[model samples]
Target: MDPHPPPPPQPPNNPVFPPQTPNGPTIALRPQMRPTSTLRPQTFAGSATLGMCRMKEWWLQVGLLGVPLLAVYLHIPPPQLSPALRSWKSSGSFFTYKDLNIFYRDSSGAVGSSDIVVLLHGFPTSSYDWSKIWEGLTQRFHRVIALDFLGFGFSDKPRPHGYSIFEQATIVEGLLRHLGLRHQRINLLSHDYGDTVAQELLHRYEHNKTGSILINSLCLSNGGIFPETHYPRSIQKLLKDGGLLSPIILRLMNFFFFSGGLGAVFGPYTQPSQAEYWDMWTAVQNNDGNLVMDSILQYINQRKKHRERWVGALMSTSVPLHLIYGPLDPVNPHPEFLQFYKKVLPMSTVSVLDDHISHYPQLEDPTGFLNAYLNFINSF
Candidate 1:
């Protein structure tokens, strides 16, 4: 197969917006200002009436001025893409899927290797999450492919769209076909949300439910594989609840919360620098992504709903399986979920990145993650 195939056709540029519109009149909900001083009664008989009239006029003036400012604030332009994202886009390209644009990176690996590794990233993050390991994999494997799932990263975030793992799997398959890899053997590497997509694909491939894609091996990093044993973030729970307060919760998200939340997922020893944090936040804010946080979070619900099908996929696949875990992962603690993987797949290779490496092993300790991956895939 030719490693440098022609780039896939790009999709038309469009914007991402929240599925459900905000309730009530957007312009009328402006906050009222407090008076600086009490209005003294005038010497005239109608002084009280005059004072009340003055108060009403003052409010009108404030609203007129504030309305324009509010419009500018609400119309926040798309954030500048981070350097990682920009370079990744420059080296890669996009393809159309059901009228949505999906971003993907397909880099040719070292010569003479028949392996094709597909990287699947987790939630609230884009394919950029694989930046640390992409180059390393390309140097060793024959081909490395990664994509931002719809509703995440550079992919089109469409509200009111089906954000199911099964849909996500189909998109992956479509990309594979677009890149001419449908009948080729694939080695799967995924983390967090990507893990679920991998499981569904395996389930389908094992049952001959999918196209010509053949699985050679699989490596799963930290994710909520066993939904029952998982502990999702508080905001995720609120979003999953689908309550009236969901809008407020999403609106309240800012750089501090987003960055701090990312930090918290790391081991105590590993802290992402401000620059790294800002890059991630920039990606999230691109195309007003903050608005669809609640909608994309529906993946948690999908995990719960399809737990059996996904888990069965994990255990029943005939190909070799491996698990690379960070024991201190706050959201998907290793103790709770690792045991399940071990019990189901007793013979699968399991590598524990000890020393409190948290959920993102590739980011926190890239060398260790890469070595483990190389050993696992190369062993067989």
Candidate 2:
């Protein structure tokens, strides 16, 4: 008796299948019970499928490259600004000069005649943050001037110009000059990238104490002053290439900041949340577009351009300076970062707020931060 089962009869139109080979063909070894798939001859359909797949891959590559250029042109991101931030602005009482808009809260009622305090805001935030202290600030100073520098708050967002920190500094100085505040050395309070703009003002005018020396003293919150010292991984890369990665970051951050929905913009630092504070913060950015100019200037151009000069000035300032910051700031925390500043600025006083505050210490503990700053300046 034959051990093998009988082979099935071939269909009328089917061609004879070729014998399977070890390398040339993949065969299911059940020869006695041949199925159509195992026995069918290879066809051009496989080649066609492969060709289609390759074509799809090629087009995908082209699209990946073209998409960014298109986005750069269109100014639309996969993510956009949240309505919370989009509507956030200083529309109430700001004076616009070209792209810059200055918001002044009258401090006429403050002391007899306190020196003018000009507040420069950080990236993604505007003069609005000052609202927390706006009443108090206006109540304290002879005048408090807060502005949305180019591309922030209610100011114009222009493109492809100098738009650098120094450029903005000139704009800020011009505003002061226009307002006749230059004659009296200006007091400066700054945070985040506002620190860099403040430094730029100091770097240009204060060093020689010559042609345009204006800023009298500084109350600096975290940032830009010490790049190499306080850099975390993300920020290190941002400066590594003059902020080429900034656009991507600006978009991603806007997405996250917006996608966060209701409670996104508010954190513990924004505590004692007043309706006014939330409104101002959400006002700075409505779309990712507003962030581009700030990111490029703050991370790419400003920090890289003045890293050494600012550090030297910070470490050995001709003018009085103070560092009032929180311990848990994401960008400029103390301990490791403070060690570097301490090494350079041994004489510079460093005050740490007890709670975990992000960048804005003044907003974090207004009473503590204000009292400390007032004492430091008065003693000086």
Candidate 3:
């Protein structure tokens, strides 16, 4: 496994508009401006028609004339990674709750008797990502559920619909109630985007009609906590804005992502380890704008910056909280942010793995990550 991380996203050097051909694609050069009160573009058709003449003609142009691109960013879909086997690596029962298909692996020891571990994966990866730690912890806990979040894993993906983090949280809550895992506080272990969905679930847990469970403890690794922290790379930023250069970039990504070779080029950008990370990276490469959707909700919707709200939720609960971080990944919340947690949370602990555990510590350093998890659960 190569230790060096992938190169950062190259600066977008293309012009906002392409050269227009007589019969080629339209080359409208419109600078993307997200709502601002700054000076407006000069209107050449002018005020001459506004007061002096009655305009009887109406003009409807293509999807991209001066028409402002009104977009509702949704969640990124996970790479459609094929399950290694229909049979479990470490097997469990199958169940469903309101459109989400869940696979529950029964724990081997007392960890299964009184408590449970519910794990979640973020964008591009499925519950399959948890197989490593799940294998290690399943024996000790009462039950270990690595659920396939809607639109991720082998779960369903509906078109033209939204994938908001809030929506995914609801589905997970319903699954818990449907599984009869209620009245017992459960430990939550989440990664990447999974961390956000977990926060929403815990915050809204009090109002849960089923009153199924409480977040006994929080174990987060490599999640997008603050947007400015893992701020969008140049490639991601340009694509989201639908710049004229977007279509080309999208096609380029599709080519590399769908290809088998060094498609893993961007894999280490998150937390470089082995080039194999790109295998999972390209799984959801075509998950229908799941990344863009996630970015919008995360960056634009205030969902991503809810660190205070998440910490506040932890404070409100008597549950013990712990953070197992991959210190090598600079973007994954620093120890300072943990101070905000300490300001309000008294029963919280922080551990950092200075190994190859970048964002996905579970995958990077499974042993250390699992130890931190089991220790936190035991503390409660």
Candidate 4:
């Protein structure tokens, strides 16, 4: 008891093992092995099938939600024309060009001067763009005219048709012809997309193409005339090259997107008012004009393809040529564009506005723009 203990007694010789069956090996039914539930073990193939079913269900749910949302967006009605826009439309009249109704405004002003100035507006916008400089122009010239290209402004926007700078130039010529001013010499004031159309018109005039307007002088402002120097915004690039996504984007384009994109080109201090933005949106919305933006944006490509034709027209023309540039324009930024322009067209004159001024110079600085243009016009 004090030092060591006796060894424990041994049991009788009998092994503690499960009884075996006569025909098979003994099976130990441990708690884990005992069939607790009816659920079967999942095989690899079954797991894969379940995953596939879940994926299909997820995609179906997404389709169910996205389809209706897209429908609602596509069916959103165009905004009604604001009173200002309505007045703009009421003042202007439509001229027919091969069954398409083109909107235009012709104002007879300044009895003393016989000179006529025709304005060609940029893309996604219309003649209303010239409204800022309209009265100023009319005061100096005897007549002022501006027109919405076939797919712009209050004009009819036809789908499934190719829209090109060439066609826009033709439309300008047709407008003049409709107004009985085809033979009259016209001073051209163009901007952005209009600049390309002006270039095409200038080409026709220089080549003596029939039905071309007689250009007395051409003044361009903040336009993408040189595709090399021009930089289109990301949205523009996407829309132009979007292909299948274009229609969807066009349908989804609302006032916010339009205004935000358009506002970016303007000088920080010269952004358009909300009402002005609404007017612009209304014009784009009218006649489902938004749908044609991608088609119209193809002009960017056209400019690259026909760079020689357009830029060459500017370089070779005998008519007085001038450029009123907004130095801060992102589309055609300063120094590079200006340097190249002077290099290309040494004979042409240029008027560089303030450093703060960006694209839409006329709207940003109408007085400066008008003075610059008038000075050019007076010099000749």
Give me the candidate number with maximum TM-score.
4
Q: Each prediction's Cα RMSD?
A: 26.3, 9.5, 23.3, 5.9
Top candidate when judged by lDDT against the true structure: 4
Error of 3 at 42 (Å): 41
Per-residue lDDT of model 3, residues 197-268, tens digit only? 777777776445354357777777666654445543334455556645654544345434434322232225
Residue 239 miss distance in model 2 (angstroms): 10
TM-score per candidate, chains pooled? 0.82, 0.68, 0.63, 0.86
Rank by TM-score, highest first. Answer: 4, 1, 2, 3
Quote the lDDT for 356 in model 1.
79
Error of 3 at 166 (Å): 1.5
Pairs of residues clashing in candidate 2: 85-282, 86-286, 88-282, 88-283, 89-283, 242-300
Each model's lDDT comes to: 0.83, 0.62, 0.59, 0.91
Please, what are the lDDT tens digits per residue for candidate 2 over residues 276-297? Answer: 4445434544333345543444
Candidate 4 colliding pairs: none
Evaluate residue 104 in candidate 1 and report its C-alpha lDDT on the 0 to 100 scale.
92
Q: Is candidate 1 or candidate 4 better by lDDT?
A: 4
Clashing residue pairs found in predicted model 1: none
